[model samples]
Target: MPRPLDRCHQHLLAALVVRLPPSLAALFFAALFLAFPALASAHEVGLSRGDFVVEGASVNGEITFAQRELATFLPGLDRDRDDTLSEKELTDAHDRIERAVIDRIQVLGDGSACPGRLLFALPVEGDGVTLKATFSCSAPPGEVRFEVGLIEDLAFNHRQLLRVGGGPRVSEALLYRKRKTLTAPIAAAVVARPSAPAASASLPSAPTPAPEESAPSTALDLFLMGIEHILLGIDHLVFLFGLVLLGGRLRAILLVVTAFTVAHSITLALATLGIWTPSPRLIEPAIALSIAYVGVENLYIKDAEGRWRITLPFGLIHGFGFAGALQEIGLPRAEVPKALLCFNLGVEAGQLAVLAVWLPLLAFARRRGWLTPRVVRLTSVLIVLAGVAWFVERVFGA
Candidate 1:
């Protein structure tokens, strides 16, 4: 064999040769998610959730939202104007906050008004606010009607995940401003579903819906959530684009994407199940770093020869990032496995959808002789810059 130094020199010289380019269309899609911070964890400010148990004539529920999100209703909630909420700040806005929250939510029992009381409005960890309320109905709990309308005050993409259970009826709804109601029938349920698996875990995780709106089952809800998440998670998309920038054989591309999928699926389960959860503060920056690193590597590597090796660890990091979002969506203890399974499936489906879009465009470019190393270099530079920017903002900014 040749001397070691000679082999090293040959390898270095080989890396200088030009490689084929990835589609520019993929880069355009990659840059889009960052432009819209409302979609991902820009400030973790876009989504809120509620959990309710309708038992007998009593319906107890708690709703949570980001502190910045609640600021839409009372601009002064954060008196210091910091993104965080202080205990005193919450105490001072007690009455107004309670009124604002409870007014937006209406709980009905068989078409009769169920007068409600705000039990407590307290600050939860992670710069969030939670308001607990109990409604006592004049009528029996035969018919439970719930309506949530926070979207009018919040961003249009802002979603409210509502999960309600009464007797044998358990329904979970992913709600938008347009879809702000959930109505379901139930026998008198004494035990709460969140705490107890009285409702079969075999049933779709927390099922419920708005009247005549054709609500998705919890599985479909999580699947759609996964797809929406990947589409909106610009950094993740950019990283995927970077991995394929060298424009290698189809087998090589599939291998790299498959490695990412398997690696992330493992961690998504671990973090979502409470096995281990690293902070988003750490995970977010790491995700950005992955994107930057991949872009840099693509500039030097002439082919996607060993990309699968690197994407494995980075995909693990990205899985934790995905978990942060799912937790915000709120998983019921009883339906944890179902939620986890459906969510992961949704994520895989989303990944497949993205690959589907990107590969076809690349194929067309190849056929037209439009793909070139120049396009790859330009796109890689942009990706590296974007990743570095996100890393800085996530690490230093709020």
Candidate 2:
């Protein structure tokens, strides 16, 4: 068997023979190598969690937000200028953090806006800072509306996992974009209990309702959400673009796409159902690496032979990435199957739509001689560069 380095050289020579001019390819590789030092920043998506309970005329809750997210609201929170935050740093800025949290999160009860009073602010063991607060309404509210505006101006992709409950009725939602307010009705009146001792931030215990009583996400909502997620996810789209850059016949294209769909579907279901889940911190960088691998492979592998080998494993990684989004948003345990099915269907629809538009344009380019071998090589190089940038950003950049 050929040594790994020998195999790599062979692949490079094969790739050059098929498409890339040797001189141009060498120059492109040299440029990327020189620019590697500057690509050390990491990229991340903003996320927060909120759990609220309604009792009588009072709404009490805790919102756990990342320390980095809190820095966006109050820059001074990170006193040492380091990217990482410590407990001492959070304690020093307790008042400012509390004010910011209270100002941004609003709860409306029975059409009247309830004033939020901060109870305590504590830094959790992780990179999270939890703020406990209460909202006092005029009377016992039959319905409550929650609005979370924290980090909205700072991060466009910021999302909040919200869980609200009173009595036996619990509702969960992912808050993003204009879908900030979540309104749910209380199933029964809950009598107010004595306040816990100062410095105690225990969450109120509410019994879980029967599966039938849980508010499940509608099939249409999940379907549309899936479609929207694919359209908005830039990384996933870039990966797909890399796949398309590997020119092939319609049958080959279908086979590659099918492999990706099937692979991701299996992982998506497993991750969504809590059967298996990998941390996003690891998955995100791996995904970028996959994109880089595909782009590099395209440089040498011209035919569709064993292409499914590439798509299958990478598709599994991509599926975990999809699961991260769903996990962040959360799914009702009772409706997991329906939500999973609809969301997967929507993803397929979106992927097909993208291919439908892309394939014909590629064919047109080929027919017109606009897509020369040189152009193909240049495009592949660019894809590789992008993947490298993302990998660096996700792995090291903050």
Candidate 3:
């Protein structure tokens, strides 16, 4: 009886040894290393705002950038080396800060450059500094172009939200390192357009060109933003990867994915629309805990039964994480629905794209007998460690 049981155990172990291609394991580990920073750094990106007002040929505006980011460009501002800028440090370095801001941001009127003059620099209530500047143009501006170069040499991802105002309407554009320039017709030009004649007026007039459309609803932009958010969010990606690593059939995979989709979508919309918002200090750590739970659970569960049950509730917590990012973009009230729809769709699209590639690779591994019990256990251990690290960092960092 002892010999028979030993033989049975050996057979079971052999069956679990899926002969996965060596390259696949290497690829997986490489990807994991690449994403480690995301798991470690809770605040992976910084956001700034630029508000521009165009009056005749002169332009004036305020640019608000996070002090942490500014420290990278102007290290002298952090005089005490305490990793934060003091009021006196900021005041003493006012000239250097002003010059840095002027060199990075530009406003062009018509074909000529509008030289910028820094008027004042002050620290905002939070971790931000506001710089006021005025622009002088050669002629009354018509088509205005805004360019931001603040991201150069920065270690982390940075975004600038630009709000341009002149006439009755205000238009917004999001700026990143790669796409730093935004061109729009000045609201002043739109206000200058002559009124259309009534049908009773006989003179044939050139069809009044429709008022230059305000930046068309940026649905595509919102979609891309969603994808970027997920990709940059290493913790989120790791959680998804843990789900995939568990190995499941198509039907089970779809069930789990659908549950996650529906669940996160609910809270994401609710929180973004100002329905109910949980504190980030709470939501972030909860998300990290969820990741750890999935990984640790994978070590014990031999089957995918009731996996969707885990995904559904955890998905709700992840939704709040997504909402925090979208809120930072400051979606306009009227564009909320469209932005919300596109952003959510984009996240789903990104999730599917990842699964589309990863699932097939995993399937091949499983068929080839690469996923041995030992391999699965090892992967789960790594995932759990990552989650714990993130949880500690986020909680203590908060």
Leading candidate by TM-score: 1
Clashing pairs in 3: 18-369, 18-370, 19-368, 19-369, 19-370, 20-370
Model 2: CA > 4 A from native = 1-49, 64-92, 120-131, 149-154, 157-163, 167-179, 195-222, 272-276, 325-345
Q: By how many angstroms RMSD does model 3 differ from the true structure?
A: 11.8
Instruction: Give the C-alpha miss distance for residue 146 in model 3, angstroms.
Output: 1.6
Candidate 1: segments with Cα more than 4 A from true spot: 1-47, 66-76, 79-87, 124-128, 186-216
Weakest 10 consecutive residues of candidate 2 by summed lDDT: 34-43
lDDT-better candidate, 1 vs 3: 1
Which pairs clash (backbone N, Cα, C closer than 3 Å) in model 1?
170-207, 171-207, 171-208, 172-206, 172-207, 172-208
lDDT of 3 by residue, 73-122 (tens): 77667878765566567667767876777766777888689988766555
What shift in Å separates residue 321 of candidate 2 from its native position after superposition?
A: 2.5
Please give me the total number of clashing residue pairs in predicted model 1: 6
Model 1, range 1-398, lDDT digits (tens) per residue?
Answer: 11234877667634533332245545544554353333335324256778877766778777877666687558877888666777677767777876777777888888887877666566665446777677788745787888776567677667777777664546767777778888868675454333222222122222322323324575687677677777766778878878876778888898999899999888888877877888777898898888889989988998777779998999899988877645654455555677678767877888899889898887788678776777777778778877877887776665
Q: Please, what are the lDDT tens digits per residue for candidate 2 over residues 264-348?
A: 9999898879888886678878988887787788788775666887899999998987766455433346546876787788888
Indicate the worst ten consecutive residues by lDDT in candidate 3. 199-208
Clashes of each: 6, 5, 6
